[model samples]
Structure formats: structure tokens, C-alpha cells
Target: MNVPVHVLKGAGGKAAEQMAAMGIETVKDLLFYFPFRYEDFSIRRLEEVQHEERVTLQGTVHSLPELRFFGKKKSRLTVRVLVDGFLVQAIFFNQPFLKRQIELGQHLIFHGKFDKHRLMIQGAIVKNAQSDGAFEPVYPLKGDVKLVSLRKWISQAYKDYGDEIEELLPESLLESYKLIPRAEACYFLHFPQDMAKFKQAKRRMVYEELLMFQLKMQYFRKQTRESTDGKEKSWPAEKVNSFVEALPFPLTAAQSRVLEEILKDLNSPYRMNRLLQGDVGSGKTVIAAIALYAAVNAGYQGALMVPTEILAEQHSASLKELFAGYPVTIGHLSGSSKVKERRETLEKLASGEIDIIIGTHALIQEGVDFHQLGLVITDEQHRFGVAQRRVLREKGIRPDVLFMTATPIPRTLAITAFGDMDVSTIDEMPKGRKPVETYWAKPDTLPRVLKFIDKQVSMGHQAYVICPLIEESDKLDVQNAIDLHRQIQEVLPHLHTGLMHGRLHSDEKEEVMKEFAENKVQILVSTTVVEVGVNVPNATAMVIYDANRFGLSQLHQLRGRVGRGSDQAYCILLADPKSDSGKERMAIMTETNDGFELSQRDLELRGPGDFFGVKQSGLPQMKVADIVEDFRTLEVARQDAAKLVASEAFWKSEIYAPLRQALEEEGVFRKERID
Candidate 1:
């Protein structure tokens, strides 16, 4: 019986269950889940090893020590082992299992790096058989389980089911690429006979992974184009221009260009799907307001959906002011909005009394309907997925969709994920805004920085002291909001302080935020929740504690918090690392402020996994190809997928018949059904 692949991937439990969520459901996925690094366990003979050195020996146990408890917490067991006439002492902690495996005068093989005073094998898996072969295959396993058993299980699993897989690529392409067969790739990946086979299989598996991804993207793009007519109803420029002129800040040239593009999409009868991504404070909200202005003027309502209530309120207030004194009616609906008020808002929306509405997910909830919501706008669109966007689109007469994000996505990634939409990036920041001065600070610099915030506050400026964690917990040691709040209260007792985090109730948060916005509080302590919203123009300093705890894009976003106003803003990244990656993150912080540049730097520092981990980066994994190294292979896969699809419509082609059947084989995740 075939259970859902999700159920099977979870059969292993806990550690691997997440693979299903990542769309790694089949033997093919397991093959492509390549190891980030390897633990080399090749052993040298005891004669080649000195005391306190790591040495792998193929010898027998000459003597076994008694397995006795030295203390309630410590189990003492030691034995003298002979490696070609050289004596070495082996020890185990609470490991009678090792004693059971090796009897006195038993021949066994041991491989581990040696230390200066004793054998320093941090993690070693031993076997009872004696051999002088090359390094054995090791699988990624956890707990107290030994590597030998993992090797055994994998060997058996593959022997029983590996032969079921059929090659999914064309014969000529596979031959020219020198790619391994699907079955052999799976076999070698698990238990490679040699290094050459491991590399050979890895190359083929990576390419196949990318090819399958490209195929899925191609299908999704085609489906989207067919479903959308690219038709839009016209909204005049003078109407929106008059509204823009009435705003406080003049619309920048980039913002003007985006408004025209949106107007073009709106005027056309064809459905419009577009991604409008920009850097922080690049005036995307202004562009959105212009488009919404045009939408309401075109005799239809507009809905602006944001991820959180604070953002919704911000948009509603800004746009409400922009549309004020006009014929269009504007309102908001959020979780905190009272029931009677909500009912009235819904009525107004349903009856077409409201021309513009801004709210969180509450806008999409039941009872909220639009008589003619011709357009749906999602702010910080990365927070929602294609499904959520589809729900918004369906709410009206196939409303033209506009998605706005501050995180500038790489173009390749935008194509793969947002393939259904045309992408427009507002790369320019407004003039007169100075670049944020970023610095890598040590723990010792904390007091001086607090002094700076103190100075800023003293000079009538508010600041944001952000932490990664909300509160103290046993699981993690990062400085939480609660702890830092107390620490700051004690140091800066004269100033009023307010704390905001994810755990607080909605009303409670709104109240505290209102106090901060009204300047009732001089300094607001917060978590990453304040990364996107709660804009206070007077807040001049944003000091992020443990900045390395966040990804590059996130750190940049946090920095963006302070630079909003004309005041000299500073972003201090506090990190002292024990690893190279940590140091690299600090380097990225100092390198460039451009989100696109930072995104590529981040991709180089991390990988496709990082993109998935922080989907907000909006980078697409460009096929089984490495954007950094495998461009040639990726280009080949792209050409092949395009050629085959164009030549005979791969969805129906004889060459792709088996591949189509393979897609149905349940081992796949995020499979795109051919239309």
C-alpha cells in the first residue's frame, strides 16, 4: 500500500520529518540532499600514530579492562589494543557497548584521529571486523547509534527498492553529460565504492534536481499565462497625478515610472500580475498609493492587504489622508477593530460604499466582501505565498494584483517563484537620505553605544533597541527583550521605556505602540516584529544586539529602521565569532548597503538552502545548478528543457512520457501537474 510520501518521510521521525515540508519526499530527494561537509575518518595504523594523535588501526584487542562505575555519572572502561606490535589505550565513557563488541584477544578495526596525550576522537563509530581498506562510508545519523548500523540499513533499503526508479532525462543528453543512471546514482550516493563514483553520482543527481525544478517552473509559467489575459481597464494619469501632487513628498522619478506601468496594466483588459520589489524606504508605499488612487478612480474599490495590523494601520492612515477630500471612501478592518465597527465596515465594503480598504489577513476573512474590488495589493508580499495571493485575487472580478516588498530579490529568483508575474524593481532610494554607517561592534563597545543612545535621547531623539529574542528561555542564550528591557531601565531610569514583542496581546501591543508613536515613551525595546512596521521618524538610532543572529537581508532591514528620517542614523552589528561564517556575516555588513549586492553576497556565503530558510530574500534556486559554480550545467539544462518543451510540448511528447509518469510516482514534493 502506498501512503502519502509525507507519511513515509516522517516514518523516520523528528529529525527528518522537516524534509517533507521542504518538498524532499522521495529517494530522489534523499540523493540530492548533499552533505555540506564531510567528517574524514580514514585511519592510519597504530605504528603510524603517536600518543595523543588520531589513528585508525586494524588490529585486535590484546586485553580488555573491567567495565566498572567510577561514579554514579561516570562509567570507566579501558583496554589495551595492539596495532601491529604497538600498544595503545582505548577508553569509553558509559560505553559497555564497545566492551561487548570487543572481547579479549579479539581482532577488530578502529579508526580515529589521535591527540597528544591520549586518543582524542570526538565522535567515532567502531566495528568488530578487521580490515586494512580505504575509509568506509558514513551516513548522517544522531543519538547513540553507530555508523555501521546506518550503513547496514541503507544498504538493505536500496537493495529492495532502488531498482524501481527509471531515468527521467533523455538518453542523448545523459550520454553527452556523462551522467550516472538514476538507480546507480541512488546506490552510489548512499554507499559509494570509491570517491570517483561519489563525485560522478553527485554531479548527475544535482543536474537532475535542477532539471526537475526547471520543468516545474516552466509548467507553472505556462499555466499562469493561459489563466491570465493580461487585460486591464484604463485609469487616467491626471487623476492620480493630482492626488500625488497633494501628498507631502513629491513622487520620485522611479515611483512615477512604476505608477505608469501599473496604470498600463490597469488600462489593459488583460489581467495584470506584477511584483513590485524595492529597497527599504524607496517610497514603494507611494507607488502603491498612486495605483490604488487610479483603481478607485476607475469606478472600482481597492483592497490593501498587509501582513500585520501595525502595517495595515500605517498604510490605512497614509492612504486615508491621501484620498481624503476626494469622492472615494476609505476604511480599515483588523482583528482589533470592534465587532459593530467591523460589521459596518463589511457592509460598506459589500455595498460598494467604500472605495478603498486596508487591513491585515482580516480583510480576506468571511463577511468581508467587495462589490467590485478591481484590484488587490499585498504589502511585504513575501510574507504571503502564491496560495494566499490567489485567495485575494479570487475575492473580486479577477482583480489586478500588485505585490510590494522592501527586500529586493535577485532577478533569476523572481522569475522562478513569481514566474506568473512581471517584475518591476524600484532600485533608487530618495535623494538627501544619507547611507547608514554600519559597524561591527564587540561586547566591550556596548557601554559606549548605550552612552550614544543616551546622548541621542538627551537631545530629544527617540531610539529603537532591538533584540532577536522576545524573552529569556532555557533553550537559547541570546539576549531577549525582557532581559534587555530591565537592564536598560536600570541604566537609563530617567527616560520612559516601552517593550514590544510577539507574545503581547494585540490590544496591549497597539497601546504600547501608540504611546511610542505619540512620544509618550522615549525608547522602545522590541524584537524583530518591529523590523517592518511601527515607523517613528524621530527614532534616530537602531542598535541590534547579536546582529549576527540574523541573516544579511534581515540585518539590512533592521538597519533600515533608523535611516528613515533625516537624522544621522547608525546601525551597530554586535558579534564576536568562534566560526568563519560569523566573521563572513560581519564582512557583509560592512561591504555594501545595496540589497541586491547584499543578496548575492549572502547567496555566495550560504546557498539555496539559505534562500528557502529566509524566503523573504525571494531568491529562487536556479535548477540543479549552483548559481556560483555550475552555470554551464544550468545553461545546458535550461536549453534542453526549453527545446523539448517547444519542440513537441514536453507535457505530451513521447520523449517525456516516462518523465511525466515519474512525476506521478509520489516520491516528489511540490510537483507541478501539467495543464
Candidate 2:
């Protein structure tokens, strides 16, 4: 089954090149080229077929096929067939060569969609003489590769080379799961005899894919826990209590509990690989600050990394204020730092003068060293990958890592995506944080929304006008920020408006954010650049244009910008949703302020791929299993993988040799360090 592609019949240089472009270079690839859809072609009499119904008919050709040309590059082959005393005409487009093989009075079978009004079939397929009445599969295709040629090549390869395919799953697993042999699964997937066979084949493939993924995740989890050793620093109760009392507000119950969990992990011997999840404005940062305080009190250093420079600067200022009365020294480093300033910060860091440093990816840059770095905490952890986290941890021997994210992930996804790390959830929000009132409107209702913004601004409040794009796109009809700024200025000439986007310079972005935070800019028209950490408590009104284009979690984040203060806040979603999914997404935003619920709904609606891009999720692309639709299968696979990894006999047996080899070749075990 691993034979060269050229060994398959009809796989010449051109065909092989096309196949290679589609990630198919071997006979095994051909066997795994699963179909996107299947069409029922079981035999049916012509007279019994209804209009617009797909059917397969067998009969004798009434007349010879005729080839007709409509233009220089357009041609069609027309043929007549008599089936059960009914006459039907079949047409094949751009297939003039079919006229040579089809003969008058010859018995043939046709499979296609029937048109009873005209008694004609638009697209028809002539079955091979040896083919029986079976379902037809429609495959994902490359350029210029006809379905007939691909089908014939697959059939020939299966007949000649299928037996050579080696099964990777052990016999015990197969028997327990009731899975068919690998070769038969491949065959049935492409050319199933019936619906039952198709479902069984698909089930086996999905289970295998999920099982491999779970096994790899569990293996990495165990490896990282055993191979790494962390600092054993204790959190003194009086020190933690004094730090909490110095804070501006009392800690929420949820935050206090999660902080206890972090303390327990820090005192343990194993490197802490933990994820702290909370909703927007749920006070996750305060918990991180407390953990960092414990590290510094224990005569060690801590580091906090964020995704954006603005966020880094914000954290630096906030941490300084939080540790005002303490002896801890906080340093800030970013890409935009001056040369002398960065050098001085680096030197201070190396000499252990700085107890904690807050920055962006600049923290991981060369020449940045820490003296006894004990803890590493990353905010908005999804923006960074496992490798980046490992690099930062490498700066120290084995630092305890706590990753914080405000974008809540559903529990089901957290198990598969972040199964390697322990999870902590801060489900409660701080007191006095009111849920922002959300509403939906169409384009015609913009006047009412604009009036509301004007009223809010008149009340000494600010507003945010968010657009999906900075510039106009010829392909998309959504309004751009630049144009929207102009329109807002024209509509409400009294209000001061400013524009900000990713294209702006770092200094310019910082200036705009500062102006907004100081209540200087009453109306800030921008893109999603303000989605993360640009917090302005005075901004009470947010109008998102084309809101349907954004995901539910993202819309929630944008809404979080407002409602930060004690005043009533409003988020107006201006969108004319065209699809049912779009409308549903908009409705979900209006229905709930809970991030975890929205995340679950978002996963169910957009699936994991769009929920978190493939790169951020750190999950390998699946071939057969869908993470959303096959959650039950995922659970089963996860349990089975745990059992397999726990059994030493299974790992040492010959049946698992191929599985291990396949995993190694795929580099599953050698992926980024979980820590």
C-alpha cells in the first residue's frame, strides 16, 4: 500500500503531479482519499423515477449516441435508452468521447438525476460492465482529473495493493471497539455496499483519529510532569493576607479559591502547567498578581507575558500601583522600549534587583535573564503557543506556569485542546460589575442607534464605533472604519471622532488609547484593535457595525470594553444578518452575558476550527472526526487512551509496534513541551 504513485494505472506524470499537490503521493494515499458525499444509485425503473430525483436505470440503447458542438470549446453527447417500456434521453456535457464507447441496441446502465418534465437527464454516468448496483461516492477533486479516471485508478489500486496495508491499531483494541480491519475500512469508505457498511466504516476511522490524538496528548502530559522539576516555594498566610488587604477592592470568592489552587501547585515539586479561565471583568489578573507576590516574597522572581504592547504597559502600571507599599520592584520591557532603557532593565533583571518583570514577547528575547525565576504567568495565553511558553520556562530551571485567558472555552473542548494542563475556572464576577445591555438592529435603524450614542456622549460618557475592516474591500460589502469615521463626523459634527486600527504606528495607537482612556475622545471609531486590553471605564456606549461578522466570544470581549464602571452601559449590534447562523449568533449575544455559555454555543455553531483557529488550538487537522459532532467518540477515545498508556504490557507488545512507529513518524511525541 506504500507503493509509488506511478505504479497505479493511469497515474502518469501529469496525474501524479496533481495528486501530489493534494497531498497524495503513494498508493496508501489513494486508498484514504475519502469521499465528501455519496449518492444513492440503487437500480430503479425509469417509469418509477420522479422528477428531480436521482436514480440508476438499466436498459438497452435505443439509438447510437450523437455528439453535438455548440461552440468552439462546448460539446455534448446525447443518447436514448429504453428501460421497462419507457424512453429516456441522457446527456453528457463536454464528454464527446462517450459517443465511441456507447452503441445502438447495446445494454447499458445510467445513473443521474432524472427530469420527468423533459424526460432528460442533465448529467449521467455510464456504469462499467462489471460494476453492480451500488452507491457512488463524490470525492474532493483536483484540476483536470475526471471522476471516471480517479474512480478507475482507486479501484485498480485496491484490487492490486490493498492487502499490503499494515494495521496500526492492536487486535485487542479492534476487538473491543468492534472496528473492522484497516483495509476493509478503506475499501468500504470509498465504495460501500450499503448505508450500514458506510456508517460502520466511518465510525472506525473517526475512532482511530480521536484515539491517536488523545494518546498523544496524554503521553505529552505524563512526560512533562515526570521530566521537569519546579521550585518548592511556600505561600505564607500572613504575607498573602497582607497583600490582599492592600488591594483597592475585596477579592471575589471564586478568585480567592483559584488563588488557593495556585498556591498549592506552587508549593508542589512538579512544574505547574495550569490554565486559569474566567469571563471578561472576572478579576483573573488580581489572582495572577497574588501568585506573583507569593513568588517574590519567597525570595524569587516572576514574569508576566502578554500579547500586546499596550496590555504590557497597562499591567506594568497596575502592578506598580498594587505593590506600592511593598518592597517588590517591577520592571517593564517591550519591543518599543528605548535601547538604553531595555539594556538597564535587562541588567537589573540579571542581577536579581527586579523581583518581577511584565512585558510582551520581548521577555523571551535573547540577553534577557532572570535570577532564580520561580513563576511564569502569561495573560491571554491563547495568543501564544506551547513552544513560546516553553522558551520562557527555559529561561529558568523549571518555573511554575499559570496561563490566564478571559475568553472562556467550553469544558468539552478544554479536555481535548488543553488536556495536558490542569484547569481552574473563576466563574463568578466581581461585585458591582453590571452586565451591559445588548440589542440588535438592522441598517435602517442606524439613526436610532446614532441618537443613543449622542445622548450618551452628552451625559459626559464616551463611545466606540467598531468596524470589521480599516479599508474598503472590493469583495466584501461591510463598512470600513475609515468610511465610518467620515460618516459619523458628518452625521454628528459636534462629537469628536478618532480612528485606530492595526495599520496605525505603535506610538499612534498608544496615543489614541490614552486619549480614549482620559475621556478626551468622545467617539472612537476603530476596528477590533480594542477587543483585548484597552479598558476605558468612561466609555458606556459601543456600536458594532456588521456585528454578524464577529464570533460570539469576540462580541462579548468588545462589549466588555464598556460596563466597566458603575453606570448603565449599552452595546448596540448593527447588522442585517443574511444567514440563519448569523442571526443565531446575534441572538446569543443578546440572550446571555455568561462567557462560558456563549463559548459552548459558539463551539456548537462554528465548530472548533473557526472557534479557535487551527494554529492557536494546537490540534492537528482531523481527517474523519469532527470535534463538535463527535464529542461522545472523543470521550470514549480519551478513556481508552488513558487505559492503553497505563498498561505496560500493551506498550511492550508487538501489536503496538506499528502504532508507536506511526506516532514517531508523525512527530507526535516530539511536539512542543507542554510546560
Give the alpha carbon lDDT tens digit for every residue of 495-573 in model 2.
8888999999989999998888888889999999999978788899999999988999899989988998899999999
Query: Best lDDT goes to which candidate?
Result: 2
Deviating ranges (above 4 Å) for candidate 2: 42-133, 245-250, 385-388, 577-581, 669-675
Q: TM-scores of the models, in the given order?
A: 0.77, 0.85
lDDT of 1: 0.72
C-alpha displacement of 592 in model 2, angstroms? 1.9
Q: How far out, in Å, is residue 139 in model 1?
A: 4.8
lDDT of 1 at 118: 59
lDDT score at residue 493, model 1, on the 0-100 scale: 93
TM-score of 1: 0.77
